[model samples]
Target: MFFQAGASMVENQNADAILLAGTDLGLAFDGHDPGYRVIDALALHVAALTDLATSGRG
Candidate 1:
């Protein structure tokens, strides 16, 4: 329901993407396209942490 409404707003407002910051959002958005770009904050955070952990470790 929210994704559908959000997608509509995205199209109407010409927005570029949606950011999924809720933990349970995965249940709704995983493997779902939602007709727009979806940014998973947890994935980005994990990736950044991985990079930081490996950066200065030789």
Candidate 2:
């Protein structure tokens, strides 16, 4: 499976974390465990935007 391959790559490369920036990539690692730390770039962007939009709210 892709997850296994990814996990293997992570282990091989000794990556601290994986960046899932693309929508499809995000979909691939969203609910499944990939045996490593994964950062959803889209989620972080959305969170930042949401916080900015709501920052002025009372």
- Model 1: ten consecutive residues of lowest lDDT: 19-28
Error of 2 at 57 (Å): 9.2
Encode model 1's per-residue lDDT on 9-45: one tens digit a residue.
7989877888778767756788877878888887888
Please list the C-alpha lDDT of all candidates, in the order they appear: 0.81, 0.80
Q: Which residue pairs show collisions in model 1?
A: none
Give the alpha carbon lDDT tens digit for every residue of 1-58 in model 2. Answer: 7677668768898878878778788887778877788889989988888998899862
State every prediction's TM-score relative to the real structure: 0.77, 0.78
